[model samples]
Target: MPHRTIELHVDRDSVAMGDDVVSHAGVLSAPRGTLLSAALELASPEIRSPGWSWVAVVDGATTAVWSVDHGVQLLVADRKLTRGPVDVFFRYFVQIDPAWLFDRLAHGVRADRRALEEEYAPIAREKYRAELRRRERELDGRFLSTECVDTLQHFGAEITLHADVACDFTHDGDAWSVRRADTMFQVFRGGGGPIASIRPHALGEAWLVGMLGASARTAAGRADLPDAEPLPGLELTASGGRWMSRGATVVQVRSELAARVAQLAYGRSVADLRALLDA
Candidate 1:
């Protein structure tokens, strides 16, 4: 059975404020008449409030089928495309209306309450409850921040490819792997604070190695951090592998925190890493 491989590319790694469209190009390599499906996931650092949507355009035709799942927006397209190139454009727009603010605010308050109940312990619950109440009171007059609005505007896209044939398709790359790689690199690159610890399963060790390798390459360019010794500590044992921090405060490495760590470790710049991945 033959397998298929798809390579994804973005026209610009980063865009300015006025830029409305970002071009995406993908090359699909498969046998002739092979049917395949492609989906693009667009995600932002912050959650969108309301009256905002993302649009996808292909061959000058705007896509009508789009959906959001767990804060990540997706656009899917299927075709009986042979080995060829694919192109698309993504646009994001938002409209704010004061009349709709109250409804959004009510939803946000409910969400906060649910999060507090699910995430906090009984002993610490009241403190957060009070804080939420205070925030609710403040929200009565407060407006959204420019920084918040700007963050909602910025987003990243990941392309996923799937084949319709009953053939074996294997790819080591995924959005989660990319995200983990970026996180691990940041912990090793070091600037603000290193990760408290990382507990990787047996299979996760390979990903950890790749991320460490990228961090090693990045560290070579820095004069201050000459070695990888001062970064987080990694130990491999029969049970699994662990990356530990030297500080008293222990911060578990998660996706969101990893993104923040990358930002800090890379001096608030991720364009180089993104370009490398895109290439």
Candidate 2:
């Protein structure tokens, strides 16, 4: 459904070049390059059936995902495209300008977009690919300009986290071995002692809550993104709630998710991470 131009045949056994999606809506090939794919999905109600099977032959590498007849509908992978409110097509997935290829196929080609691309050079009987790659400078310039952006300086730091936490745990049912938190070494003005300990697990849990709050906030602002579950911690104006943590790690994780959301919402110009639940 993502690609309207490329014809999708419901035949799985057939091998064809440029047949983007094969039978059962499986991806067959990429648009002439290494198998740097954005995402892939192969599903079936009869997936476990002995006959239910398929393969992807991207750049001559044979690969199969689902061969079991089990009812399942899932997002098969999580690349940048999965985090997006953006299309999973060539624009973000394949990193290609969606309209540039047909720029020259405008001189009255009596067919659909696919026909314009396929018959572009061959049907006219010329060298291979006569109308591809015309505007290299313009395309590359824009892409490059967007890439080297420290654009949202404050946002960048919050999206990624660097943490150092250590604790001790024992195998369950051991009964003899006990779980333990790392020693919180203290050197007071008067003396020094190990006053208490820190639970690495609690720290991690709080950090994750903060991360989700940030991810949810940005995801909410974008019109293209689907509605996500509510984050109670996200509601607190300042400082974390009972679950969320108030620290650099939480901020960093939120920033990472926000930045990705920004990228996905690029064309629409949604310039924020904090807003209404239905922004």
Candidate 3:
């Protein structure tokens, strides 16, 4: 589905200041963001007036109602079906209460508020991103002096011998080097045209995935709740009123692997890194 963006609009003609902006429409461009948010009750927001009779504009056009309550009676379609006394109408929805009472006012307010997200969404996303950045910066401090060999081994380089059939390997101080993987192919095939080669980084996706696969430890502790979402890297077995949290999945990275991962980007430049890393 294509993502639809909604903007709150306080009708300059209807949702006016002091319940009257017809006399002063030009002087006051009806507030749309924070100032408009302060007008609604925080818990149960509603339009102060029932004069919000305008249909919703989707991508800048009037949208037809698809359904109301998803039931048989509500499937009826007609503008007069939603009519209230003297131009009071429901452009978006009609919320009938549990006792079958028409709760038109609340849902009417919800139309634009839901569109604008009550104007609270802007500040909420800002705070969330700021906090995440702060925690990331603090976590990256552990990798300033981390050893590359140790970090590489955390992703699996210690026991992994760089063994390719055509390439002669050399290991010195836990670091391996090679001239080219296609050297033997060139000598045998008598040097073909310009060639392409692919050698994934020493510690790459396979190594990261292997670390996860080999870490299933089967924890001894049991969970108090029998029904609960499984934790990452954990399996659950429900027996008598409690759940056994098996598969602890202890990834034995020297506690600093993530920090080192952050450090590895020390010199790279990426515009949208979203972290304290220079990249």
lDDT to native, each model:
0.31, 0.26, 0.26
Model 3 alpha-carbon miss at residue 264, Å: 29
Best by TM-score: 1
Give TM-scores for every candidate, taking all chains together and pairing residue i with residue i: 0.23, 0.14, 0.16
Instruction: Give one digit per residue, the lDDT tens place, for model 2 in 4-57.
Output: 222111223322355435433333332322122323332122223342323323
Tens digits of per-residue lDDT for model 1, 67-168: 232232223345554433444444442222222322333344321324433443353445544554565445543222223122212222122211111011
Candidate 2 — worst ten consecutive residues by lDDT sum?
169-178
Sorted on TM-score, best first, the list reads: 1, 3, 2
> TM-score of model 2 relative to the true fold?
0.14
- Note each model's CA RMSD in angstroms: 23.0, 24.9, 23.5
Tens digit of per-residue lDDT, candidate 3, span 47-110 = 4323122333222433222222221112112222111111112243322221121223224433
How many backbone clashes does every candidate have?
Answer: 0, 11, 2
Can you tell me which runs of candidate 3 are displaced by over 4 Å? 1-126, 138-279
Q: Which candidate is the best by lDDT?
A: 1
Residue pairs in clash, model 1: none
TM-score, candidate number 1: 0.23
